[model samples]
Target: MIGAGAAGLATAIFTGRSSPHLKVLLLDGARRPGAKILISGGGRCNVTNSSVSERDFWGGRSTIVRHVLSGLPVAETVAFFGEVGVPLHEEPGGKLFPDSNRARDVLEALLREVERVHAHLLTAHRVVGISGARGGFTVDTLQGSIAARAVVLAAGGQSLPRTGSDGAGVQLAQRLGHTIVETTPALAPLRIGRADGSFHERLSGVAHDADLTVWADRQVLIRLRGSLLWTHFGVSGPLALNASRHWARAALEGRAPRMTVSFCPGLRFDDADARLVAAARERPRAAAPTVLAAWLPASVAAALASEIGLPDVALAQVPRDDRRRLSHALVEWPLAVEDTRGYNYAEATAGGVTLGEIDPSTMESRVCPGLFLVGEVLDVDGRIGGYNFQWAWASARAAARGLATTL
Candidate 1:
């Protein structure tokens, strides 16, 4: 096994347990493995979601994702963790975290499982190259080189460079004659340009529930509803993260999709207008910002009032044009997305080795015999919850099964 990440660790454990007679080497470049796991989920380590589906992911084919995930279902994962002395508890959005609420516990349990299975895990053994095929293969690492029958590339993609994954695995796959799907930052924060007169700067540090949508070529790309946090650079949080993939892909295509946010989801323009009109009559003496604060943050309301040209006067004293403008702005405010924050801040990569190059049932490389690919190293990225971690687990299991049979 190559790379001692989440998928690599799981693969090593499963492979060692299945075929004990076969020698297994879990190699990683990091001085201490599982850095990503340690920092994941605000250090709690979201292992998996209680309910996961192909719909939660993007890239390759949904059928492939469905097949991989179904192999080792969420129930199996939860049960395995429980048996390994890391009982998990459910949180909102079906997120499963360790009962201890410590990522160290999760990593320690997995490492202990690897040791129990007698898998040799070597840290700082960065794999530099791989050559040969089928029964004979040589894995060249910075530390040394080893001969193996098969190699599994779970080195991950170019996200969180500090964690050790820096797209090295993707480059290795390309040299071995497999097509890459061209990677981009997924689940990243979008950087909004002030060209559109955006008030994002003024609304910084504010967070609220809102509906975000990406529009491209007069078509709705994606719509998401969740908390949005306004940062000085851009928007963060669940809603913005979910919509970022569409925006990034569209920008890559030069389409430059238009992004919009709705403070009141499902509120039409007419309805929003009427609501504001009624508010004018009811809270006539109230400040415009105070009235809008019913749906938005106080800072956001003030920023929107300033941006929409709503006068500083009382709600009822505002001009008709200003009132209607505020209503329209509240309904579907355009977000001037300039670019994504890129791999630096991205939670997962959008693309990598295309799924077509690997068998969905086994995660074995179709282009290169005796080669397997798994996890974020492939063209698969899920939404911000625990879906991505679930993918890592499922894909690793599939690859391990293939290795057990082949070895």
Candidate 2:
């Protein structure tokens, strides 16, 4: 196994533990493994979600994703963690975190499991290149070289390069004859230009529930509803991060994509207008800002009323056109998103090795025999809330089973 990160660790552990007679050597370029894991979920380490399915992911074929995940479902994953001494507890959105609430505990437990299975993990063995065909393969690393019967590439994607997953695995796969989908930032914060009138900048540090939608040209591409945090840079919460992949992928494909947010999550323009109308009727003496504050923050309501030229008007005194405009702004507010924070801040990568080239049932390369691809290196990325971690575990299990069959 090359790259002893999340998927690499899981794959090595499953392979070694299941087949004790086989010698397992997991190599990682980093001096210390699991940097990403350690930093994930705000250092709590969301191990997996209580609920997961192929529909929770994007990229490649859904059928392929479903097949791989079926090998070890979320139930099995929870059970596996329990078997390794890491009990999980559920949080909002079904995210499961370690009972100890420490990422180090998760990593240490995996490392202990790897040792218990007698798998030899060598750190700092950066694989520079791989040569030779299936029956016999030679992996060249910065530290040294090793001969192996089969190789699993789990070096991860180009997110958080300092964590040691700097797209090296993608390059290695290309040399071995594999089609790579163009990769881009998936769960990354969006950088907003002054195009949106700098309202977001002024609202920095404010968080609220919202529905974010990305449009490709004029078509609605995708939508996600979650907590949105207004950062000094722009938006950095779950809603913006989860919707980033659609924007990044659309931009990479040369399409103009626009992002809009509905502060009233499930309300449409008509619904918001009716709501405002009802509020105005019910409280005729209330000032516009005061009435708007019923649905938004006082600061936001005051700001919006001031920006829309209804700052001092009473709710009933406001014109119908002006009220409708405010409703539109509340429901379909367009954001001038310039670009995302990129891989440096991305939690996962959008595109990777095409799934068509690999057998979904086993994650074995159809182009190159004995070459297994797993984890973020493949064309699979999930929304925030532990979906990507689930992918890592499930795909690793599939690849380990594949290795068992072939080697």
Clashing pairs in 1: none
Which candidate ranks first by lDDT, i.e. highest? 2
Clash count list over all predictions: 0, 0
Stretches of candidate 2 exceeding 4 Å from the true structure: none
RMSD of 1: 1.5
TM-score of each: 0.96, 0.98
lDDT of 1 at 132: 90
Ten residues in sequence with the least summed lDDT for candidate 1:
194-203
C-alpha lDDT score of every prediction, in listed order: 0.90, 0.91
Model 2 residue 55 CA deviation in Å: 0.8
